[model samples]
Target: MAVLNEEQEMLRDMAREWAVNESPVTEFRKVRASGEPEAFNRDAYATMAQMGWAGIIVPEAHGGSDFGYMSAGLVFEELGKTLTASPLLATTIAASAIALGGSEEQKARWLPKLASGEAIATLAVDEGAAHDPAAIETSVSGGKISGKKTFVHEAHGADLFVVAAKDGLYLVENGAGVTLTTRKLTDQRSHADVTFDGAAADKLAGGGDSLLDDVLDRARVLTAAEMLGMAQQVFDVTLEYLKQRVQFNQVLASFQALQHRMADLFADLAQMRSAVEAGLQAVDSGFGVARAATIAKAEANRVLHTISNQGIQLHGGIGMTDEYDVGFYLKRARVLEASWGSSSFLKDRYASLGGY
Candidate 1:
């Protein structure tokens, strides 16, 4: 078991308390009623910004807490329990891009805003199908980017877009030929089909074939961390439901078959945690982060998918009903599984890295 330090534990507790008190399931219910792609509570987001949660992974020079990936992952876990819709993941991933590849001036300009939550940015990489960075069909020419990015998360409200075009990675200002067609996804977060028609953009960095690879690898690891949190919550909720849900003149927890199922799920969760932690450590350890990230993501997808379905199954019909919150977990699990890359896609990547 990986132990968190006192400060890390405090941060996790703080995030858990805030998410439970402020952005509870009721808040999510309200957001669902609002018919918005990004279902986050605006006031809650502002509170998080004030608390510096948005900049947890950013450097101190950029108005951030300068916390590392492990610390940021702790906060993400708490946020996952609520399935709170925010741009934290997108912002953190984008910040890494700047930190790793951006010019000094670019970092000085964007990191502060990103860290301050004054700007929302998302990585635009997927053209369509197959999560191949090489399939990036978007083009850049004459300081302009033109292409369509599908399934862009939180893009409906993003102030900036870090686009991966064929010419290079470009940062295009919002509304500079950026047309957003919002998509209503199962998770109800703000996702859109973004079209850039000769959008003026500033080049961030270029010259490396592995730039997109590195970015996507970071995305996979971070996303796996989020999925781990979601799976943990699902397990907790299901366990509680089993204890209270009476059937056959006894609680469901008393059933031997269900007990065995829960045991299996516990093992799966433990394995997932190991995978995620390994990937997190790999990010800074100079290990093959690309391969580690793929394994982490694929394992997370499989475990979370199983956990979500089993949670619903264990909850009986109530799990399928809108009144129950487990359905939301299932929906979010499906979306997260498909995003970044599917389980099969990541598995293939992992095998290829192994020279299979």
Candidate 2:
């Protein structure tokens, strides 16, 4: 675990409290039951914005705390524990893009609204089913962007989109020629196939050639933070279940084999946490971000996959039931594993970065 300062500690504790008390897994169940296209409570999002969580990376002049990515990761970790459904992650990633690449005029126009959560934004990078940023075919012509982005997160809820084009990144509002075709996934969250038919686009040209890679690195790291939380929760929940569940007149946790399995999981969880925190810190320090983010997300994909599955197997028949919260974590974990990058994708990226 990262050694947090006083302010970071307070923020993490506050987020933990709110996630546990105000927005538990039951809240996600409510969102699932509502079946709203956005897949989250608007009021809950407003409350999060009011708490200043939406602007963790935005500059202070733009109505944000500018607390950095580490702080943002802390909040995300807590939210992940309870499977909180909100556009906070997508919006923050969009905001980071603008902060990194937008001009003064662009920042003035969008950052404040994004910081205050008055509007929502998300990144649209992949055109195919997999996470391949290099394969983006979206293009901008005559000040308009035209392409189809599949599986756009928070698409229905986005007021703006940081779209990836052949030349560079562009900012397009969710009006005019923009259209959304809903695509339901296992997670049942806000995702869509966004079609931009000659939608007006403003170029984000200031971030240089590496802007997209930088933004994606941030996405990978923050996402890894969330996965870290989920893995931790699954481990904790599974451990508690083992202590209570009895078989053959002995508690499951009392079995030496079961204990050994858990001990291995505990070590894997520790390694995942280390990589994730390093990724977050790298973003803040502006050092080795690509390498760190790759490692972070890869470890996250590896450990969370193991932990969520083990949680199900350890819980026996009850784990697969809808009544149990463990199943929900497993479902959510699968969705997130494919987001930004998968374990295989990250491994390839890591090897490429190392010049292997």
Q: All models: lDDT?
A: 0.85, 0.95
Candidate 2 ranges beyond 4 A from true positions: none
Pairs of residues clashing in candidate 2: none
The local lDDT score (0 to 100) that residue 298 gets in candidate 2 is 93
| Predicted candidate 1 versus true structure: per-residue lDDT over 1-356, tens digit per residue | 46788988999899999989887777888888998766566677778888887887788887888777778888887888888878888878888877777887888999888887788888888888446666878998888889999888889668888899886688888985999888888888888889999999888774376777787888888888889989999999999999998887999899999999999999999999999888877886758788888888999999999999999999888889998999998999988998889987887788888899
Q: What C-alpha lDDT does candidate 2 achieve relative to the native structure?
A: 0.95
Worst 10 residues of 2 by lDDT: 136-145
Residues 208-292 of candidate 2: C-alpha lDDT, one tens digit per residue: 9999999999999999999999999999999999999889999999999999999999999999999999999999999999999
For each candidate, give its TM-score against the true structure.
0.96, 0.99
Q: C-alpha displacement of 133 in model 2, angstroms? A: 0.9
Regions of model 1 farther than 4 Å from truth: none
